[model samples]
Target: MPTEYSLPDTLDRIYTNQLALEAAIMELTLLIEQQGHTEVGENVRGALYAIGENAGHIKQGIAKLVLQHRGD
Candidate 1:
């Protein structure tokens, strides 16, 4: 029997989202660094934090892929 095809599309969507989030986080970091401590400083700091948390998740996903491919 043929396997379902939905999973690859879903994986691609997720990977794209992760890339977009990473790019947005990079931009936000730049903006915050340029603005320094000001009225928007707190908000920017929160964004930076959220980015770090998201990055941790991305790293885990990548690690799992590596392990799976390596047959570990």
Candidate 2:
């Protein structure tokens, strides 16, 4: 009876969106750097570093959530 609105599904969707946005931001940051705005790009990259750090933990947590629900 589990629908798409279930906990694991919701989290997975959110994670997917997170990854997509990260990619988009990276592309934009690269473009900014190419345009000679190195300082702006560096600041954006600094924030991206933090986001990348947490992304690993978020992915692992989502995997654990899905695994735990497999037995349900």
Candidate 3:
């Protein structure tokens, strides 16, 4: 099979999707809190915290991969 997308390109797309999902989930959490679901919102917030941290790491890793590819 012919190669379609490179590793860096695929990882970047994944990162983009991750960010979009994170934003959508955050919006939902806000709406949930507004509906008096503080406990649920809090739980979601905790999960979001972990997601946010991993996102930063993923972003950095992708950047490094792109930079390395450019040096090739």
TM-score of each: 0.44, 0.86, 0.87
Residue 27 deviation, candidate 1, in Å?
Answer: 11
- Pairs of colliding residues, candidate 1: none
**Number of clashes found in candidate 1:** 0
Q: Cα lDDT of all candidates, in order?
A: 0.63, 0.90, 0.89
**Candidate 3 residues 10-72, lDDT tens each?**
899988998899899999999999999999999999998999989989989989998997787
lDDT of 2 by residue, 1-72 (tens): 575887888998998998898889999999999999999999989988898999989989988988888877
State the displacement of the C-alpha of residue 48, model 3, in Å, after optimal TM-score superposition: 0.6
TM-score, candidate 2, is 0.86
The TM-score measured for candidate 3 stands at 0.87
Q: Candidate 1 on 1-72: residue-level lDDT in tens? A: 222334443454676786687678668767866777454756766776787687767667766765664563
lDDT of residue 37 for candidate 2 = 96
Question: Scored by Cα lDDT, where does model 3 land?
Answer: 0.89
lDDT of 1: 0.63
| Candidate 3 colliding pairs | none
